[model samples]
Target chain A: MSITSLPETDRSVPLNRNRRSALIALAGLLVAEVVLGSIWKILPQNSAVSPNVFTALMFLMVPPILFFIYDAIWGIKSRNSKMASYPMMLIALGVFVLGTLWTVMFSFTNIKIIPLFTPADWVKGFVGLANYKRLFNTSRWMDCPGLTKAFQSGWEFKCAGALPNMVTYAVLSIAISVSLGFLLAVMMDQKIRAEGVFRTIFLYPFALSFVVTGHVWAWIMSPEYGLQHSIRALGWESFSFDWIANRDMVMYAIVIAGIWQGTGFVMALMLAGLRGIDDEIWKAAKVDGIPAWRTYIQIVLPMMKPVLVTTFVIVSSGAVRIYDLVVATTDGGPGISSDVPTRYIYQNFSANLGQSLSASTVMLVAMAVVLIPWIRVEFGKKSQA
Target chain B: MANTSTISAEPSGAKPKPFITWERAVVYTVLIVCALFFLLPLYIMIITSLKSISEIQGGNIFVPSSNPSLAAWEKAWNSACTGLYCEGIKVGFWNSIKITVPSTIVSIAVASISGYSLANWPFKFSEGFFTILLLGSFIPYVVMLYPIVIITRYLGIFSTLPAVVLVHTIFGLPIQTLLFRNYFASLPQELFKAARVDGASYWQIFFRVFVPMSVPIFTVSVILQVTGIWNDFLFGVIYAGPTNYPMTVQLNNIVNSAQGGKAYNVDMAATILTGLVPLTIYFISGKYFVRGIAAGAVKG
Candidate 1:
């Protein structure tokens, strides 16, 4: 954040006279309320002043608390407008800070269905690591039991939920989409015809939601009547694209659609990166007699390292949050074979709060891991510059 | 926009290359193939939606519909079943509009102001909150899912369009604020200082100075949010309840739910209907889509 780039601190001006007096008056009233036993009882018991906890809180806390902030740091004569953002900052803190911490803290308790935070509930419900344990070895959380060799027969595997599935989805989606996108970018860089047309075509799928993409691709890949049937009707009797029905192959189906939807955006990003590269680099490579592909591999890719990392991080983070696509296409189907972290957290939200919370906590961790380094590089460079 | 670079093994001068060269052939073949692959789904959806169910089930998907019709589209919009409620997906469309309009306006208004504040007025530890907001964009919804539910329920607006609206506004804050913040920060600081020196209020400066200068960023934020909130299925499914499901959620239900024998034509029609809004937005503002990403890319 450009903390060092703040404008020069101007001379402090005194507070506006009326506003200062009003603040002082409010502060004095708050002090009196604090000292007095009951300001509410001053009115007739049946009178207009109906003192409840909320109004009392508004009276006793909000004014004095806001006054402290103003008088302490910001209530200066010079800066009249900066406090306009205090409410926005307050909201950001509530959503990002309180919401996150609330989720993490409750993740430790046995909040099986709904959160109950009474003192007795805490005594009975605090179960450390219990939810985490279930996330791995339990029935719906067992790291891809489909491939564990126990469900080799006609057995439908219990989705030992989010574990390696999320990892697998993230890795595969990022790797496949990024490479495919880079290849497309290099191809587009050849000064091809219909460049804008091709760009728009590639990115149109990115515009659609995963639900649409999932269903269309589901129809396309389903063996019942999609590509498989169409190909067979066209005399390719042996062609089969039944990945959605197969357990281990379902992830690929999702990833293929994911790549289709995402690769276009990545290509767009990379194309932007490619365009930003100075033409002199290409001229130098030409003078050195390096092949074009070699120049790209050795020079261009390295130069686009920041863009590449950002794209990778982007794809990876999006992949980890794979809920709607999975829900739309297979719905964790072909027998719980393609369960992801997000779907797992959602499916268990009401059934098992602890499971959902702990799983969400893990997702929070996964998100942090993906973003921290990118943040450092992105904002760090700015502060320095 | 094309930057025609000189090749290593070629003449330095700009010369017209042979159109039928082997490399040109390879490149065109690859590009055309990719274009087709990208175009395949849209093509399939259009034809499938137009074809009769009998044709879709029995005939090849690649072949154009010999007897194309809008019956499926009519059914999808007029009478498609989503559970026992067979009033069609149009309900979702209207609900989507209802949700999207308010969310887009409120989110943009709040975020632009916050962005203006963060960029112009660097109060103490404001950077700290901005960092949290930027980083908060990366937080998965699963973490905030239950907490938002509790909050909405507490506010007595659970399972309603308002809840979804609030959620979109909250989630849209990080990126939208970032877009405006970075845009405002890039502007000549002299303008801001000059306004302050002239005794302009925050609203005065935002409306006159900042808003006048920020049309493109505003457009980008609008495009991003309209498409985003339109395409959203998760919040619509969870927070909006059954009565307020967005088009995406209803489309999924219409396609995946098996009541009678599956109606591929109607499903495809509903799919196209759901996708039409975003697809149109993507085409109209495709350049801004990419530009917005580049502006908000991690180098920020």
Candidate 2:
């Protein structure tokens, strides 16, 4: 509603009305939960629990209640709150909390904890790092048909040491995505003709989902019907580039696709930084007869450090979460040569149900390793500044 | 260094030609080569999409001699098989639009309110709340995905249109909030104070005073959120359900399925088709790009 022109005397009316509506919403939510729970209690145990309908209902309702409680408490303190005092905040918060609780409860108790909570019996079977250990410790990974076929007959398969192919994929892809992004950004910053067109071309890949870009790249890199084969037809007799198949080279192939998708983001960020540069410096540099290369190296590079850092952080974040591209491109194959952490997590959660928790643990650890430093730097910068 | 000083000292004598002259032709040359390298994949994608599958397998990818055909396009649009279904990415087009539109609107709306509150209202907890929101942005969304999936399922909307939209909104919140908040914070405080003095209430001030002035930032927000939600595959797949799969998911199935030989022509055609919406948005909104950034939402 209109919040700007509320007379001082009338402000309390809307505030009170909002609070009343919030309470009603919260109450309605509670009643719905109780009704669903009662219905759940009445149904035959087998039928009732099958869909986890009761748990789902509770999960849906609890978020608004929690949010209502939060808003009520905050409302009392503020006393003149408007829409903020309503149940929307409570709903969002409630859903988040209830969802977490339901998921956790379902994992431990085999019973349908809630309709919304999926049965996690398979995941609960393996606690802690057991699943992780099994994944990393297996020699059978090399024996997978996808892996063997991708590597061809002559190649020797290396046993995974600690992390699986997926985790390695995430790490390597992220590194390549961010670094190449930065390099592209720096290159784009140079004063050149057709810069706009070049920038668009670079960014065009970002517009396409990983599914589209990944598939296109997969085809281009395919051995039989791809660019490699086309090149071979040009009478380059000894030319055989089977990157998508070679286990050692598979990650690089994925990285090449990633770089193609990512460099545009970096270019945009860097160009933003470049345009923000104070013109006075350039004029001063020219006046001082500073060589163009030296100006960029010594002056401009240092100045764009913040933009560079931001780009690196953003790109790296996307990199570590690599999943869709790998799935779309290689399906974690030419055997698991191109598996990334997210893909591994997805596989466990969806297909290898028994290993879901273990996969999550790996994902959590990988994310923490990358994120902790970033969070620290972010906070450090704010506090220091 | 001596020559540099001489040029500066002789500002009136003869403007020492532009700094980026033909002597710096190497820079242009390098950029041109880089540009070509960058454009090569796109060229391959377009040409491959236009060629027949037989022609695609026949010879040189760079060579356009293979008979150009719309067969792949027709397949991509109308009849590519994704599992039991033979309908193409078109099946997911409306669903993607449904998920994207609401998510974008609600996200931009909530972010505006939150951002406005942070910028204008002197609430005691605003900064703390904003800080937490900022921190939330850093959490790898993948970590949150499982948790969110569980949460959404618990909410009984896990594989529904609303579930996907909600997910998008939640994920989009931090950046959207940050963008608008920063943008609002940069605006002159006097205007806000003046509006309040003129008896403008919070909502009025937001709509009449703040929003109208936020066109540039809004354009930026639209571009960012639209691209993100429209191109998203994972969330769309998980939350949007099979009934509401986005084009990207369909595109994935068509291009990535492990069953048979790779279909290069159809795959490229589908990729380009699915990317069209965002590509169009980018092209149409080209003029807004610089203005969006210039409004200083990203300024450090």
Candidate 3:
């Protein structure tokens, strides 16, 4: 027999063995899932199921399901007939599935039952969209006279509208940061001496976590011991920029701090896109007598679409997840005007168990809205490519 | 080459004009102005750190006074009260270092191996596996906090040094994996192919061929990871038990106590001290940063 063409018997034997193994693996996974499901139903609210049992079931179910889907898709496209690699793929899938299941299930259970592995009565208690309703519903908290008066009137009232403050902050911060970042990136990319140094200086803030940078900026922005007071000392009779205390502009103050930390991230992305441009393209443009400004606007920018999209996605995600910096600098105050989604979620989770699930659900929906389109576009491009 | 020649010829043929023009001068001036704008915060931070609380409160922020004292620095380092304890942020410096170092090492190691396997090894399900991992990166790290905390608590390690370190590593995995995988993918495939032909085992190829060639990217990883782990405050606060709080946590307490008066000078001094490690790393590794980005190691 030719080496390229295996003997009939040898091929048949290996093919049969492979088919048998895959079928066996599939059956084993089904059996494991069924056993786990039945156990979940019967086990006196989780008392019977071992932690290891859950982990093992997760491991088995995740890998085969993922591999089967992958193989099914692969089979449709290619003529190659090979079994999927299993181990790492399985673990990855298991971690995803089990982690998700654990999160969803654990959210319903309390501390006492969590350790004992007993299902809480709350587990079966279907709150439905009640959690989500409370999150977005203004009336729930508005019933409190203090909260109602606070929102209607000035900072005198302390009626804290949860969602409105965070949403406003995120929208303003994202708009300002992305626009300014793009502008700065373009300016720095001009053919000027010390451009590299400028880029470095702008990008340096990204290297420090918001916690560190926020503190520095907070001190500088402080009215009493910072720039505001300092400016007054310079023979200016009236210098008062106290946004840190002013509820109306407090969110903007937080945004200023955020921009200081975040603009560098956007600039770095834009710079990468700028640098990736071929030198020959610029030379060709010069030969064509195209002005540098026009060439950048018409030609270079179109080519940087992917980079711009990536920057937007990254920045938007960062905007939604704004937490540590806000907490560090504002602590969601000047009476909660600087509250953002992640901070809101964190506050709910830490303070009240009932509200935590609602906040998490809101967060999940927000992330989904942001991420789904980006992921779809990304996968779509990859598929087309 | 032709373009360069043409440029030289045109410049020579044209009347010899001065290299520096009014527009160029304006551009330079504007650029300098922007540079100063960026440097203002740093300028303020340094000056504030060197000044006393009296001067800081007295409001001379624009100019470094004729008498800039290191009293705040002393207070920040050893004597500023952050709760009942009068100890300064120096109390948490070693704990931060301990947490940061191990967390950085473990996260980078795991990410590199995972990235390498996904990039070069081409196991049957590598693509799908990697996709999941990539998706995991986009999940807000905060969302994972509750689940991770619960798991850690169940594991009997919550509110400890290890708890904080593990949390950092888990959170750091996504970006680190992305960085390394993209980097390794960009490397010449022939390197791996050659190793395979030479009967090199998986571990051998990774250790000998791949790891040696990874120095540039490793520096980038170190810079990014060190900055991330060093400056993490939430994980430090939530997971690191009180005795093991990081500098950021200490700084937060000093700046953000419920009823206590905010000490602006002490806070500034503490903030600078907390940022010192990563800032030093950036300055030292400045050369590697551009090269690493150019090498396509960091996507953003």
Candidate 4:
């Protein structure tokens, strides 16, 4: 219960004083954490972060911690355990945040398979742009046939690495999924018969993991006993749909699988967006004698900017972080032709720490670029309203 | 979803069903075709999983097996090998259950509590803490992978079940917290105030009043987390490691492993088995699944 809810005599000056001191102590802890966080940021790139320092920091918080525990127990007796969750929130901040910050910091280092974050390995590990330079210069990373890499110097861009493949995957998947999703959503919105059945069928793939989707599609795309065999067995005798095996067509195969897995969710989101539109808009358009197609195109579609943005963000995020699908399907086969950025980072994580982290840093940058605009549009509108 | 019932310009129940219009036929035709495309993989999965090796090799992928047997399913469950091990995918299935149950419960508990506090308590830095949590949700797991590995190793839980659980909880925190916080915040303030006037403590009001009123949101959260965690491949592959590989990881291994001759039937069986959990949830928790996804998408 709140202090104000306490009976006048129960809420004594001493109790109020205790509450005030506890608040002051918490304020102190907050200040200390802020100081520590800044110190963490300023620490040398390659310098080892000792666990002992964290222990010492924990040592400093013991008194306030004990007081909070004591207060929570006291709260249990008198029903005032509001502060029970304060530590949990701190844990979220600590557990959820440290790894990200640490990864970003370690991105500047040149560690190998073993991480160099500990004090023992903190010797001359910092290499500013070396990892990035190597990452970019590597033929595998920089080479693609017709995309961004192809425009660069031909001699250098030999191997079409994960980077170009990732770009291709993201761009193609995002565009295809959004459009296909929108189209399906519009058709579903027609209020056709057995709508639930249609919706259920459309969205079931989304419930499956990328691994499941990848393998299922991999089987379907397999040249030997898959569709090619099935079609040829139907007496066509000449069906050559081996996209999954062809290096040039493998990425497209992955893209198609990605679309099948993701477009339904996009459709669901778009459908929600469509349903959320005020019916009055439709009525208004109808009163103006506008055709149904024109109303949807010229009127309803623009009204769905928020939903479109949300779908874009969701689909694009899925597209970028498409490691599992690739691993389960092609395993980045045919010499890493279907590799995405996240998969590249994951592979390198076991082999080259510096390269893995540099790749991760690039992903982090891309993520930031994608999110900032959406956050502003989303939260900015909320704040304004 | 679009409510383009705009064609007739009639309001509500007054609108008449058009008589065999070409557009209607076209819409139904497209929907049926799209439905086929969507259902084809799952259909193929089931049929292939049921087929024996000979039947599958006989050809015609679309056709059901004439002599469908449980042999592939049994092999997938009890003998499918991922490289050296041939204990089937049952190990991974049970491991997934272990991972999913605890991860779902613990993450929901921690996130809901923290969310409740953030919504009602309104401490000085709640917004700042929330901002961090929000940003945490958006940060790609790849970016956080190495550091998490280090932390997990430092904690000596790396490559173990608890490490996977911890990682899931950490990643699940932001969105789960956001879901609960928004749900709680949208609730009427009067109930909270009434409880306060009656001298009820935080936990009392939460359990007594709020919990009863929170069925839908709780269901939504569960659906989101259950599917989300069940479908997790990266964390299972990494933190769970080889010994504790979850079903998705194991399924991938069984299918993608380059060992003896390919076992397409067994692989498909294992894939279906891996997918069954979330598929069951999707079919059962249909509306809540939709609501959960919409909420997840709209979550800031």
Candidate 5:
């Protein structure tokens, strides 16, 4: 046990008194493990290991191994009593090691034999930057002769890779959602009748899953039977809202639906921020003869920077991991025109493990680039206080 | 909590506005138009789900059908085909229940305990681990999904309902812990000191004292977890194999399947049915939902 630096109140309790006993307990545990191993070796005659037995053994081994290592390194020698934090630490360590650390390790490795499905197989080699080249090398598709027609039609023909699509999706969705959300928040801030109903109407979509929102919006965007069809039936025959089916316009259609679902959340956050502003600020602005729109744009929004940052983080995070909405809406239709990084990661996982890891690593790097500085300030403030 | 008073105060203060002012009329018009934009898809879904197939195919899609029928809803609930199962979403209804109920309970329980531990019991390495966990929450699940599959497969729980539940509890840990921790930290410290002075064990005090006081936060946590777990798709699709698929997964399969002829009405009904749980919670606990989001967003 490392020296537990307890607060003044806890200093009276001498935590190191049990070090000798804990050492003895550790030895006893080792003996028990040895005995159990002997028993297993003597009793097991089956040639194949049962998966259930293997899992049970893993569950049994983790705690003892954790405790044993901790005792040997810190618990037996340290003067701190942190037994209460042990469970939390154990779970955190398990999750970090097994869930995160392993995945990160797998990102750079090439597995010739997938071990999880076939346990006895073991083939692993480290391949540096090979997978990344495959991910970022959009020239494979860009060299296609078919895109020449696309280039001639005034469309900027570039790599039709998942990376470009994801970037476009993220940038467009975030810009539209945040700006539109701010507009709605400004509108809702007006002291008007049926505010509750209107607020509910606008924000209710936030509660529904992306699956549901994507489904409903897909139907509404259907050119044959949706808003366009309905509008055409009324007398306007040239109505064309075929964004869902159009390869060029499908990404925008996705953005519209995304904005629809996310704007409400952003608006709610901004509304809360707006409400938090003092009434005196509004009165002061009014007394100075400032226009309402000017007040919002110049005064209120700047004051709501914290709220804006929070909303940006939330919305951008959603954009980063967006998969279900795309699957439910476009499914990357019209020949992968609307593919996002997450969808690309998922698809590649089944076919090429290295490619999937490379794509997901790109996502992680993108998120970290945005999040790390904010996290530093957040935690830095906490540590300072 | 801070803005509740302000929010309620707005409508009453504006109740005496002039009935026919131009500005008021414009505000109302803008709000009504925005409301219509928001509500149009829902209206279409409800109406189309109630209309006959012929009406949906031939008539104006937005107009209400003269003869409303529950046949689509019935078909969605009782007999919609989900892959090989002819029994519709109800086939996965119980599976979802089995996955959601335990995942919610266990995730909330673990996170509450973790929150309580982190807030009340300070340790050398605890804060660092908490920070890592919080940051881990922001890391996209795709980064961890494959390794989690490998781990679960090694443990032999992959492609099972238990695997899905485990995944939820792991993924749900960060936000849930953040919620409970913040809520518990805001609580009066004297209650904890008093309980400690009374010789209450950690579990005892938690169960007998803090748990009771935590009912409201617990409600919020439950609401968050239940809706999240129930509405989950990616985890369910990946971890919970065909036999254990949740409602959302099954709904997607039913609606998005390219093999069969599309039944728009039944698809809408199934979509609505799958969404009903979360939507109900959203409507019923509207304020708490807002509170949950605010708390999560701020802390996150």
Candidate 6:
């Protein structure tokens, strides 16, 4: 049940043999998998589906096997009893089957499960890198008619491709939303009256799904009948706010709506971080005659590193998988100017399955880049502390 | 800090107190402006929904409607066309509830048990699987969408609420597991030790000791899960066939579809209707929702 209640002798029982055996098994599996993978890799370039499927299956098991190796080093400990290990193994196996295995399989291959009885189309030939090439249009740029003009003018909005547009959208939205949220948090931290009301107002949007947000913003941003129309009716005849209709500026329009929906949650997170700070710090700064802004910048902000990192991760991940917002707002319109990766994947999945798979694979890589470091830093700190 | 009552309170021992000051005015202005920016869409949606279509087209967006009406709201709830059906989001309301309730319960149940196991029983390589699962959470759902479709089809649950629920459970495992694991881990080791000493088995301890003591975190998980499952669109759209589409997906179809004249009022009402569940949860849960976000955001 608990660490302190474990019998002294039982607690001292070394897991030497258990660890050694697990290590040997893990090593044997790793060597076998690698050798088999290489052997399969050496098959003729046009080889049959079996070897490819085998390689994919091999890749799928690598993470779980690696986990086995890790478990080898870290002995399984249950309160006072070795019985727990058996149930734990069963549960781990269940999780692998349910959670890890399918995603690994799906991300690697293009499987068609229709025509229920047929197994022929189930395992498609490995078209490694081909799908990805289609997504990035790796070779198409060479034949692009406006290539020299685009190069001369510099990479304008969507000048490169959907991938670059997505990258830009993610970066810009994260930057803007986080900075705005921080600014709002600072204001809210001034200990003003009606803080609860203000907080609720800011956060209500976050609670609503992106679909609702996207529609509202789309309406608000529409040129003919939205903010522009209303403002123009107020006697500002020359007024025009048509970013939503303009291809070059459409991404910014989407970014604005994203920031609107997202900033509130970021504010809530930041405000919590602000409140967690010691009140004494402020008094100390006051006694030292430090300006409030400087106190925030030089003293308080640096102290909120953990909160900042958490907020950054939340906002950035939101930026990464921003589909509903774009779908509701632009639907990647005005000739695909506001298209994001998720939308691109959604629209193309049925018609262009391989390209869509490749796009998602690209997204997987992007997600790893964003998530891996945070996971390390987060878990790494906890283990150390 | 308390001595300076409103921003106008002068430093003690310095000069006469002013009733109002530039700083106070600036603070009020900024807070009000920000509040207005946040409320603008809600205000617009409400007024637009209430106004007659001609009144909406009349374009006095900020003005109170001369004849406020519930017609749009009614139409949105009971009569607006969503795809082939003239019946509105009401058709999908039951579907959303059906998906959300079961999905929330099953996901949270799995999460709580798995969390307990990971926390109390530290099996060999648990951390490795935990890490992999955590990493799996970050992979965009788009990557898994088609795969899941195929898998669900193969399992014969495709185009059903069960399929959506299953997908939600799988995708939701990491965070829910993390929440429960963290909550359970924070429990005093003494309680667990005492339970084990008293011969409480794993499930017995989890049920008797862990579950009872963990209601606060449980409530937090419920709020997060209910809102998440209810608000989901992509899974609801793709997995739940036309007959079973959730409110968000149906709402999107109704409001954004290209067919027929743009019924702005109906669209506004539909948007509000879809948003109401989460909004209600937010307003009702109050601090729990905030705590849930905080809990969800930071690792401890």
Measured by lDDT, the strongest candidate is 1
Report the lDDT tens digits of candidate 6 across residue range A268-351. Answer: 878777777777898899889999989999998998877887677767777888888888888777877777788777776566
TM-score of chain A of each: 0.78, 0.68, 0.67, 0.76, 0.75, 0.68
DockQ of each: 0.43, 0.27, 0.27, 0.48, 0.46, 0.31
Residue B98 miss distance in model 2 (angstroms): 2.2
lDDT of 6 by residue, B164-232 (tens): 888888778878877877778777878887887787766799889989999988998999998888888
Against the true structure, candidate 4 has what lDDT?
Answer: 0.78
Model 5 lDDT tens row, A1-385: 0011112343122234345656766687667666655555555666344345443664565566566557666653222224444444555666754556555555666743363332232124566767676666653212233456674666665545566666677899999878877877777777665667777888888888788888888988888788898899999999799989997788889888888888788878877778778878988998899998899999998887667766787688888888888888888876788787788777766778777776777788888876765565465455665
**Candidate 3 second chain TM:** 0.88
Which stretches in model 6 have alpha-carbon errors above 4 Å?
Answer: A1-124, A138-161, A382-385, B1-21
Residue pairs with clashing backbones, model 4: A140-A161, A189-B1
Residues A39-67, candidate 2: write the lDDT tens digits.
Answer: 86677755614346677557756745786
Question: How should the candidates be ordered by lDDT, best one leading?
Answer: 1, 4, 5, 6, 3, 2
**Clashes within 3 Å, all models in order:** 6, 28, 3, 2, 5, 4
Stretches of candidate 4 off by over 4 Å are A1-82, A85-88, A118-124, A144-159, A382-385, B1-15
Candidate 3 chain B lowest-lDDT run of ten: B1-10
Ranking by DockQ: 4, 5, 1, 6, 2, 3
Query: Over the stretch A1-385, how does candidate 1's per-residue lDDT look in tens digits?
Result: 2212334444233354345644665676567666544665575767533355324344545644565556545544424334556546755787788888888888878898867745577668788888898776765665555667665776665444456667777888898889989988899888777777888899889889999999888888888888889999888888888999998789889888898899998988888788778889999998999999999999999998778877877777788788899998899898888888888888888898898899899888988888876776566676676
Indicate the residue-level lDDT of A151 in model 1.
Answer: 52
Top DockQ prediction, candidate number: 4
Instruction: Evaluate all candidate structures by whole-model CA lDDT and list the values in order.
Output: 0.80, 0.66, 0.66, 0.78, 0.75, 0.74
**DockQ score of candidate 5?**
0.46
Over 4 Å off in model 1, which ranges? A1-74, A77-82, A117-124, A144-160, A379-385, B1-16
User: What TM-scores do the predictions have?
Assistant: 0.88, 0.79, 0.80, 0.86, 0.87, 0.81
Of 3 and 6, the candidate ahead on lDDT is: 6
lDDT of 5 by residue, B1-300 (tens): 355445656444433656688866777787788788889878988998998878877888889989999999999989888777788889777888999999999889888888887667655666687777777777888988887777777766788878898899888988888888777776787787788778765678788989999988998898889888887889998999999989888888888763555788988998899888888998998877877777776533
